[model samples]
Every structure is written in structure tokens, then in C-alpha cells.
Target chain A: MGIQSVQIGFKHICIMTTVLIALILFLSFICLIALPSPKEIIESLKSSEMIFSLKLTLISALISTILVMIVGTPAAYALARFSFFGKRLIMTILDLPIAMPEVVLGLALLLLFGRTPLGTLLEDIGIRVVFTKIGVVIAEFFTALPYAMRMLYSTFETISTRYELVARSLGYSSFETFMKVTLPMARSGIIAALVIAFARSVGTFGTVLILAGGTYMVTETLPVTLYLNMSYGNLGMAITSGLLLLGVSFITIYMVEKFGGRKI
Target chain B: MSGFLIVKNIHVDLGEFKIEDITFIVDEKDYVCVIGPTGSGKTILVETIAGLHKPRKGVIILDGRDITSLPPEKRNIGIVYQDYALFPHMTVFDNIAFGLKKRISKKDEILREVKAIAQRLEIEHLLHRKPTTLSGGEQQRVALARALIVRPKLLLMDEPFSALDFNTRTRLRKLVREVVSEYGTTVIHVTHDFEDVWSLARKVIVMYRGRILQYDTVEEVFNRPCCELVASFVDINVMSGIVVFSNDKTIVRVGDIEIVSKDRVCEGHRVKVFIRPERILISKSKPVSKFDNVVRGFIEDLERQGNILRVQVRIGSICLKCISTPNVLGSLDLELGSSVYICFRSSDVRLLVES
Candidate 1:
């Protein structure tokens, strides 16, 4: 039904509910914009630990997004185009990290690294993951992987396999077809996926907290910094980190919606 | 062995629609249309030939090379889909050159080849436009250019014109014929439209229920469908009639109506009669030709079939469908419940078989 032609009483109720919901969101966003005084934000930014966390957060999120696209593209492609044994089981396991709580995933990773033989071998080789910067990357990677796969899978699914067949018939090998044809077609979806994965990686807290221990300055990504600062009664720093996250998420949603056609 | 493209006894099990021992051959430079009802395994058969789907049984040989086990890219066979699967992200030039680039590494050679094919297909002007911006016909032409520019050994088109407007279909049909012939490429086209068969195909293969019923020259299949299902599938009006009298002209009585046929049958024998709807004429007045078998009937129903109007006439207990141009129908003052004279030549009424 057209909104203009709705029943009067119901329309009034609906419009009131929608406007009220919008106002709630608008007021909250206004608080985010207004709460951090310019001086307070500058002070938080000037803090050496805050600067380290920002730098580390950006680096790790970039690394994770790249790793996500590299690993997730093929996995998504396989799940989308190929028929193989144990397909459904593989899909379920890949999505389980997304379905389960991030803290639980972080806890599981903590145990496997702290108690498992693979972790011991890596430790013996002078490489460590638990309670380290490397552990931060690992936790963020698993947390953001399912989101990337979901995006890339839907992206690959929208492209007609016929195009690939045509490319193949025209004499390009399968890999070439993907690069010249499938990749170009899926560019927009890739952008959307990158934005999402980066945002997820940036906001990842519980997993990073549990695995990396939310140390004072070492493993303090943005979310970890917010958690650690709030626990220390550093309201200005905590609010600053939260606002930074909110700004990144706004950009992510804006980018996706702007180029939303490619999303599945 | 009979031709450059041979699909021998191919069988593919796709769960919903199985290709059961399907086989056909296209002589060098021959344009063959594989016509079938929906779910008749036409796409599956063409895909099998294109190396998109490996057949469970049988072999596909193109230019004397066994390609059944090869992947689609290695077989060098191009396919054009009904939806014109032109890559939306690429400009028309890039799309046409996409396949060409794989074979030719030099930029100028690829440019020259793509421009040549695009010019021939009259889509050279659309090279800079993305496929999404091009019209449906333009997109299909770009698709054709992309397939043809590669100089494939075999080109498989899956209902390419099925999604285009009639004017565009007619244009693309001629364009496809001219371009493919110029390249001397063998083509296997899958379509349910008879127009594609009549306008473009040198040979026609009639399929039904995932099986090939008849494969022969287009004239032979249209005039002489090998099975009852094929006859009906091709839109022939089939009716069971009893042979009333036999002579130089045979008379058959269907229900309370009598039809004249050229095929002789023994008296009192039951037979199936086949007549194409386009072969029958609907006029308000009787034709003076002695060769015409005229019968009076009231219009039972009228359905608009694109440019033609299909008038179903109630003749005794059977409804005979007669197709007439809308112009003819408009001037004839025809309507439901209105009486009209439907006539067909004795030669058009073929006797299928005696039961």
C-alpha cells in the first residue's frame, strides 16, 4: 500500500512510530558528535599509547582485510561454483564463527594456542600467537572471515556461470577468465566486502581481549583500547575510541549502500 | 565422422532433466537448431557439446578432436545465452576483446580483430558503452561478436533470440547467419521458436522428454515429424479420425466432421490427422477452389499470439485451431460464438497412421 493512501489512524501511528525511532537514533548520534570536546579528542589522540593502538589497529585491520579477500575469494568461489564432497559441512563450519559469540571463539582459540601441540611447535620455532600482536591478527582474521565469505559468496553467486563458460569457450583458461571477467564483475562486491571486513576487524574486541589479554598498550586495538580505557575510568579516551569506531562504521554503511547493487 | 562437429550418443544426468543418449552432428559451416519444449534437455545437450557439462556417456568431437573430456575453455567453443551474458562491467569493446585477448597477446591484433567482428555485427559504435547500457539486441550482438571473434570451432547458442523483441530477433537471426557463415563456423543453436528454425537453421533436431525424436533437414522435420509427440510439439493440430472412404482422395471423419486427405487409407480404418494451424484459413465466406476442404464452425476461443490471432473453432466435438494475421482477423468481423468457414487444402491434411 502507498503511504499516502493508508488508513488515517494506522498511518498516524505508523508515521509516529517511525519518526520516534528515527529521533532516538538521531539523538544518540548527536550525543556521539557532541560528547567529545575538541580539546579532549586532541588530548586522547596525543597520548602515546592511544597513537600506538590506532597505528596497530589500522595495520592489523588492513592485513586482516587483505588476508580475508585472498583466502575468502577462492573459498567463496569454490562454495558457489563447484560441487564436491562435504560441501554443506564445510559451509557450516565456516559460518559457525560468525554465528557463535565472538568471546566464545576467542576463548576456544586461547585454549588451542595455550594447550595444543601445534601451538607448542610454533612456540619452539620462536613464533608465538597467544597474548601477542600475532594473536590479535589471528583473532581478527577468524572473526572477519565469515563476513567476507558471505559477501564474496553472494557476489560470485550473482554472476552468471554462463559468462565464465563464454570466456572459456573464447579460449581463456579458468584462472584467466576469473581475472579478466569474474573479478571485474565482482569489483563492487569486493569493495563492499573490504569495507565490511575492515570495520569488523577494527571493532573486534572480545576475541582480541580474550586471546591478546587487552594489555595496556601492546595488543590494544581500537576496541581493546576502548575497553581498557573505560575500565581505567578514562571516560574521554573511551568515548574517543568509540566515536572513532562509529565514524568508521558510518563510512562502511555509506560505502555499501552507495554501491549496494552488487551485494547479494 | 559424418561432419566436423559430431555429438555421438551423449548422456547427461542433471537430476531434474536427463539427456538420455542424445546425439547429433553438424557438417562443417552448418547452422543447426535444436528445438524442444522446455525441460527437453536442449540446453544440456548444447552445454555437453560446449564442454560445459561432461556427458555421462558418449563423445563430442569437434574438428576430429575428441573434446568430451576437455574443459569448456580448452575446447574453443563459444556460447551465447538467452540473457546475453555479456559481462556488465566491461565495455562492449572489452567484452568482444575478452576472449580474443586470450588467444592473441598483441594489442593491435586484438583491436583489429574485435573491430572487424564488431563492424560486421554493426555494434562497432557500441564498443565504448557498457553492456548494461546497451539495448537487448545490442547486448546480444555484442555477445555474438565476443563468441565469433574467437573464431571458435563450434559456436553454441542457447536461445539467444528468445529474449529479444520480434524485430530484433529477425534482425539478429539474419546477422547471426551472415556472420557465422563468413567465419565458416559450425553452430549448434537451442531454441523453442520455430522462426529460428525456418529463418536460420540448415538442419533441425526435434527433441522431447530429454530424447531426440527426429534429426534431419529443416523441411523434412517440419513436414515430416517422425513421432506423434514431435508433431504436437511443433504445434501441429493432431486429431484422431476414422477413414470413411478411400479413392484418389481419402475422406476421414473426425467426430461429426469430415476432412479430405491426399494419403490413401483403407475404408473403416482409424487414423491420426495432422494439420498445421497456419495451413488452415478462416474466412467469413467459402473459398471457390475445389481443392479446398471447407468446414463451417463457430469461434470457440481467441488468443493473441504476438502478431497473429489464434482462433479456436468448434467443429463438431473437436476444436480446430486456425491462425490468421490480426489484419485478416480485424477485417473478418470475427468474435467468440461467431460462425466462420475454415478451409485447408487436401495436401495439408496428412494422415499420420492407421491404428
Candidate 2:
């Protein structure tokens, strides 16, 4: 009798508790969203500075997403397919940014490009990254690269190397096989990585601030707008930027489920 | 030395499994079956021939040209995998036209060539569909069509029909025979199924633990296996029988039944008789072909070994295992507790001299 009553309690009580927790969490987001009036949000969004920050955010995220995919694809393919010395260490280091705080990554990039010989060597070549828009791009790339690599690495791991071998036997070169076979097979994964990368790059604040100084209307992105406005007690501006970020995230999630969900 | 394809001393170390010191040759238009257990390097040898894997130390010569350093694309070889890796993103027609597209620039000519082979393989109707929408047998045909459409100098297959149903596998075997004869393309196939050896192979290479145990004609390998490993692998039925001198035929008395063999045997000498299951025919009454050996036995049991249905019969103290089509068994109404006659020719019965 006791066991039967315990099973009944688990069936009802556990589900109810889970629903309650989820409901409270969702209500918290709703409360955060209601902090700003729609009219105040419209007024803040109308500001030219907010428009400039939004445009800069989209442009930098696009560039960083491209940069991440360009360098991450080959790195992910090699790590998934080949055996090399220090492979474990390399994988761990590549994944470290995703695990560590974004601030740490920003500080590390700041130091490396701050006053080091490599930084000076670049400065001699008329290229400066520190406290510049390029610094924002660099920070976003480093912050977004690990997630892109992880997505593509697992994608390559699921594909059979035999397909490449068959293409080669059928008179296609290795590079041709990669473009023709591996790329098409991994289309879903590439798209997922791109979406994740763009989202991460747009939302990157701590790293961008540390490296690019979150300069008003210059290195300021959407996340930087939110951070700077919240610090200055401009709740309307911060909440509007946060809402825009949420809309982008919602679109990305919908695109993922509609296109790439079945494949994954 | 004069063979069209020669693999001289191939050694590949893949950590978990390795094929060592492998040497073999195939004549023009020869169909060779590499038979072995799982992990015996059969697939590796076939892949090495296709130039997919480079030998650690060996020379691969094709048509008097040393192609040891040539890449797979330059070697002009084609391979079909067991899973039928048919480019899921491409239509069946595009998959078949993939290799031809590289060499033929004319769009119409490529279409004509692909259609020709597609019609031959009976997959012309499926040309517009993606591979994922096709059945296993249809997918296998598409894979075959893709490999054969390019008219490659050498074709390597790794258990190509193993993933198909029994009926489809049988039909594909006939199709393979027809295509090979029509194209006259030399082939190297890896398989664990005995039916592949019987129906498709002209020569057989038995491998064990990465080395060739024996390589010979189908007759030599089946009749006179070189070692116990090969014998057990081929599973030839051997029976202890005593030789008896008849008028002109050398008769062997196994249990209470007398069987005839064409091999020379002295009178009153003990010998071991070897025969294959498919070589023995089961009949409702005595067979009329003047077959030398005839024995009466009752059906002991029956079992299905892949597509071949094996029947065990009890004739006196000795039991014999034989295979026949299910239709034949049905037509004969043979079942357990049913009596039947088994007949075989003198040529099918080989006598190994026992001292």
C-alpha cells in the first residue's frame, strides 16, 4: 500500500513541481521584459547612437562568423580525421574559451596584442588591434570559434571516411572530394555552427569591452550597448537592446529546428 | 609475372589489424574472390588494389605500368562499398554520372553514357530519385551502376550484396555475372559468403590472419584444399570409406552404401571421400542420369544457412549434409522423418588417399 501511494505521489507531485519551476523561470523573463515601457523602448531605439550600435553589432558579428568558419572548418576536419602529437592538448585548448569566462579570453587577447613583440610587429606593419574595432572583431572571433569548431568536429565524426575514399577511387582528388562530398554531407552542421557563431559574436560583451574599451558609438555593439546603458542607469536602452537580442535568438532557434533539427 | 595486375609483397599495419607480405596477381578479365573470416584483411587487400591505401612496402603494377606512387584518381579504378555510399544529396542519375562528369565535358554525351548503363542495370526509372528514397536492393543497383558506368579498368567490391535480402542477393549475383561478361572488366571481390565464390568467382583466394592461406582455381580450392584451415573454411564434406575394385570404376564403400569416384584407387585401400553439399542431388526416386553413386537416406533435419537451405540425411551410420533450393525440397516433399535418395556423379566424389 505504501509503495503504491509513493508511485502515485511521484507521478503527480514530480510533474507538478517541474511545471511550477519552469513556470516561475518563464515569469522571471516576462518580469524582466516588463521593466521597460514600449514607448520608452521606442524612444531609446530611435536614438542615433542606438542605431549605430545595432548596425555595428550586425556587421562585426557577420565578419566574425565568417572568420570563425574559415579557420574553424579545416581545424575541425583535421582534429576529427587525423592523429597528431599533442592532439588532446590542442583540443582542450581550443575548447577552453567555451568553458572559461568570456572575460578571461578578452584579457588574454588584450595582453597578447597589448604590448607584446607580436603586437609591436603588427604595429610596425600599420595594423593596430588594441582598443579598436578590429579588437572587437578579434575578441568575437576567439569567443565564437570554439563553439563553431565543436559543432563541426562532431559533424565530421559522424560522417564515414569511406565516402572520401570512394570519391577518390572514382577519379576525384582529395580536395575535390572534400568540397563535393564532405561539405554537402555536413551542410546542416555548418549552418548550425554559423547560427551559433553569429549569436555568440553579437552577444559578446565582456571580451569586447576589455579589448575594445566599449567606446561609445565606436566599438559599441548590441551587448556593449546593454552593458554601458545599464551601468549609466539607462534601463530603457538596456531593456530594448536585450529584447532585440532575444528576438535574434528566437529566430535562430526556429531556423535550427526547422532546417537542421531532423539531420542532427 | 605476365598477369595484367600484380601486387608484389604488400604490407600494411593498421594497428588493430594488418595484412602482411601479401602477393598476388589477376589476369585480364579475371574474377577473383578473396574469402576469409572477419578481420582477415580481405577488404584491405581489395582497397590497396583500388589505390585507396598505399602499401608500406610493395609495388602495384597494372598492365605493365608501375602504379605504386599513383594516386587513386590516376589509377583509373572503381570501388563499390557495402553500405552503397551513394551521395545522399545527389539524384541517382547524378551519382552515376559523377565520375563520367570529370572526364566528359559534353553534357549530352554524359547523359547518354549514364543512361546506357542505367538502362542496363534497370535503374533508369529511379534516376530522378534521391538514394534515401530507394530500397536496399535498388540502392545496391545504383551503387553498381555508378561504379560500372565509368568503365573502369579494375573494379573492387567489398561485400557489395551483403546488405541485401536473399532474393535480391541472388538476383544481383546473376546481374554481376552478366555485367562482368559484357564489360570484360577485371574484378577483385571480398566476401565471407560461399555463394559468392560458387556463383561469381572464377578463382578463389583464401586468407587467414592477413596472409593468403591458399589461392587457386575454384576446382582446386574446393576439391583439394591446401590445409585444414582452408578445408574448414570451405566446409567440404569428407567421409571415411574403404575402396573396392569394381569392373572399371573405383568404388568406395562408406558405411553400407557404395559410391563411385573417378580418381585412381587400389582395391581394398582405405580412403577419405570429399564432396560439396550442392554437388549432391536429392530425389524422390532414383535419379536417371546414370550417376555413379546412389544412396538411400531419411531426412534427419534441415536448417537455413543464409539463402542456401542445408539438409542433413541419415544413411546407415553415416550422415551427409547437402543443399538444395527450397522449391526443390518442396517439390520432392522432403521433410524430417521422410525417406529420400541422394545421387552424385563420380567426378563430384574426390578420394583423398588415406594410408
Candidate 3:
């Protein structure tokens, strides 16, 4: 009886999915036909604000991705390979950002950078983060770190420790083995993580808005550009940025699928 | 030689498994096979010797030099794993050349060494291919070549043939023995297969529950197991009985059965006797033989394990298992409840030393 009901449920799900896909296609078609032409979209894209936001988004996303990989690789490797005091607590805290709401993370980062000793230390060092382009990268880094670390952690976890043991036995030090063997084996996963982190950083909005304040032509990433322009009743500019963000997401996912060969 | 390799009082506690008071030694070029069941800390002990694990307390001396604190890489020891841990990104040639590359600076010389070793292992044809494309036997040979090409102080194998089919395993065992002998490399092989112990091992170390139970020559460990656990692990029949007479041959009586063994034992002393299953012969009727021990019994059961057949014959209250070939079973037409004669030479029975 349960099997029969499951079979019926599967049939219903298949029908529902087909209907939902068709509805999405029809709505997309209507929107495409009703909206401005590609010429107008291109003209809007040529605007100085649009160009600046796109450039800033790419640059900051690249920086954030590099930062995330630099910090996340070692963090993930340590979590996957070692056992020390408070390891579970550290892992739990690392994973907390993944489950926490974006606004909460954004507000937490804002307070830490705006009111804490770290903020004052940075201020004394002449490194102004809050309300600056640097704040955007800092926010993007925090937002994308959890996702990048999760990918890298699982990737390192999938590789057996025996490979390192074999390398060590072959007269290579532990660090050398990791560099020559483990890192090479985990290359695809690292590439996938970079792609994902870059995409996440490019699309980040709430944290950037709270920390960088989303000022026009200064700290406006693509998501912030979309939000700021939409609030100003600039629908074409907002949708153009939206389409660019969608294209970036599409390209990143395509590259990850093409090169990674495994789901990240 | 003066104990070429010595492990003195090694102790390691790794939460799940621990080794305590482990002490053993192997002469130079001695092929020692460590046999134990799963979770017996056999792999851990070898890995510790390879410097993969730091023993909480111990000293590993190789050729009279203490390498207790040396890392595996610095120790110049090679290891071959059961999975054949070849680098997937590298060609077979590069995989074999990796360690040699680190040692030698010349590229052409590295190529020459790799080609020579590959030719020796008969993997020259597969040198350009990736490891994933090779068969289990080919991959194992490549792993062995990679380890042996380094010419390390010692070579360790962790159940290198356990993953292969029976035919592949036997073939690779012969190949491994030949290659290691050609290299004149000292080896420590860990295996659960007694065939490996019999065919390749010069020395046998039997381990149970994180401790060495017996370390001796292959013949001694197989023919004369040290304890009941080693006896069962080695699949030899162990019986505890009282010695009744001591003359040219020692006679032992178990229950109402009398068995004669050539091993020296005091008369009227209680002793445990071990007899290998393959040493016993099955005949349809009582045969004319002066070899002494012959008992008549009915076939209780038959079990086919690989090529050999295990025939269970009941002699009074004790049910003895005798190993025979399929041809013998077919020729004798031995069936259940058929009366048969179980014959074994007195010299084949061993008297275990009491602890």
C-alpha cells in the first residue's frame, strides 16, 4: 500500500514539475516580449554608473575570492585533517555563518567593524573599512567564506589519509606530501570553491549594504547597484544589473560544471 | 648479523588501537611477514616503524642507527599499500620516477632509472599509461616498482595482495618475491594469508590484540603455533592431552584416543599438540604403513575452501578436520557417513611449548 501511494505521489510530482516549468517559461516569454529591446538594454549598460558598478563588482569579487581561498584552504584542511581542543566548537562556529540570516551576519560585521577594538585598530592604521570599498570586500569575504570552506572541507575529507602516509614513507615530509600530492588531488575542488565564492561575493547585497553603505559610484557592487537603482525608480538600470548578475552566475556555474566534473 | 633491525619496547595509544611492550628484530635482507586478524595493530606497528605514527614510547633501530625520532621521508623507507596509492595525475613513469627525481638532479638519468625499474617489473609497456587504466596486478607491480626504485633502507607492504583475485594474488606474490630479492631490500610484509607467509616470508611474526604472540621462522610459526589463538589463526588443529609414554616417539592420549608425535616431551606430562590439516591423509580403508598414527572414522562433513577440500572425520569423541585435494575426494568417492582411515606421520605433529 505504501509503495502504491509512493508511485502515485511520484506521478503527481512529475506532473507538477512539468506544469511549473511550462508556467515559468511562459512568464519568461511574456516578460521578454513586454520589456525594453536589447538595444535599450545595451544603451543602459553603456552608462557610466553601470560600467563602474560592473567593474567594481568584478574586482572586489576577485579580491574576495582570493582572500577566501587563501584563508579557507588552510582552515578547511586543518578542520578535515587534525584533532585538537575545541575542534567541534570551532567547526560549529565556522558553520554558524552558513545557517545565520544574511542580515544578521551583515549587522554583526557592521558592529564589529564600527564599534569594536578591531575597528579602532584599523582606524589607527589608516585602514578605513566601514563606509568604504574595502568594507565591501570584507563583507563579501565573510559572506562567501562558509560556502568555500564547506566545499574545501568535503573535498579534503574525500581524499584518504593513506596517500599522505604513502608519500611520507617515500621520503617526503608531511608538508611536502600535502603540497605535491594532496593539493594536486584537490585542485578541481579548489577551482569549484573559487568559482562559487566569486559568484557569492558578486551577488552579495545585505552585508555590503550594511558595512559599505552602498553609495553610488563608490561602493556599489552589482547587487547593491540593483537595489540602489530600483529604489531610485531606475528600472532599466536595475534590470540590466540583474541580467548581468544572472549572466555571471550562469557562467560561473557553467565553468564549475565543465571543469570540476563533480557537483561542488 | 647483529639484529639488523630492532624495535625495542614500542608503545602507542591511538584511542581506538594501542600497542604495548612490542619488541622484535629482523636481520638484514630478512623478509618478515606479520600476520594478524583485523584491528590487531599489525598495520599500526609497521606504520610506526615507517615513522608514519610516532610511538608514545619506543626506539626503532635500523642497521645499528637509532631512527626513532626520524620522520618517514628522512628515514628513506618505502611503503606499498593494498590500494596501490599511485598518483592519479601522473603517468606510470612519472609515478615511479617521483622519488628518484627528488634524489637525482639529472632528468635523463631519472628517465633511465624509471625505464630500468619499469622494465624489471614488466611494466615498461604501461609506463605511459595512467594508473587508473591498469589492472590490479599491473597497478600493484607499478606500486612495487615505485617503492623498490627508490632503493630505501627497508620496504614495507601492507597486505599488498589482499585486494587482488586469487590468480592475480599468487602471480604477484611470486613477482614481488623476485623483485625484492633482486633489489636485495629488507622487507616487512603484513598479511592475513598464510600462503604469503609460506611462500615469501623468511620470518613470521604472529600478532593478536596489539601484541606479538610469536616471532620465528616461517616453518616454526606454521608447524608449531605458540598458542591457541595463533593455532586457530593459522588454521592448525590444536589438542590438549597428557603424554603417556616417552621413547623413540612421544605418545599423547586425548580422552580415549592415543596419538604419537616425534617432538620431545616428558612422559605423563600434560601437553598441547598441533597438527596441520594438510599433513593428514584420508584413505578409504586402513592402510599398511609404519608411520604410526592411523585412526578409523566416518566422514562427518566436507567443506570446499578454494582449491583444497576440508574433510571432517570423527574419531571417537574428537572430530578431526583433514585437508585433501578435489582429486582425492573424487577418487576416494568419500561421502558423508562413509567410514575412512585418517593417516598422518608422527613427525608432522608438534608439541606446543607451554607458557
Best by TM-score: 3
TM-score computed on alpha carbons, candidate 1: 0.90
Candidate closest to the true structure, highest DockQ: 1
Query: What TM-score does the A-chain of candidate 1 achieve?
Result: 0.93
Identify the runs in model 1 with alpha carbons over 4 angstroms from their true place.
A1-8, A11-15, A25-37, B239-271, B282-306, B311-319, B325-343, B353-355
* Deviating ranges (above 4 Å) for candidate 2: A1-18, A262-264, B239-260, B265-272, B281-320, B323-344, B351-355
* Alpha carbon lDDT at B306, candidate 2: 60
Q: On TM-score, who's better, 1 or 3?
A: 3
lDDT of 3 by residue, A77-191 (tens): 9999998999999999988988888778888988998899999999999999998999999999999999999989999998888888878877778889989999998989999
Reference contacts recovered by each candidate, as fractions? 0.94, 0.75, 0.71
Using all chains and alpha carbons, the TM-scores for the candidates as numbered come to 0.90, 0.89, 0.96
Q: Comparing to the true complex, what docking class would candidate 3 get?
A: medium
Per-residue CA lDDT of candidate 1, range A47-160, in tens? Answer: 998899999999999998899989999999999999999999999999999889989999999999888998898899987999999899889999999998998899999998
The root-mean-square deviation over C-alpha atoms between each candidate and the true structure, in angstroms, is: 3.3, 3.5, 2.2
- Model 3 residue B339 CA deviation (Å) reads 1.2
Off by over 4 Å in 3: A1-15, A18-34, A262-264, B353-355
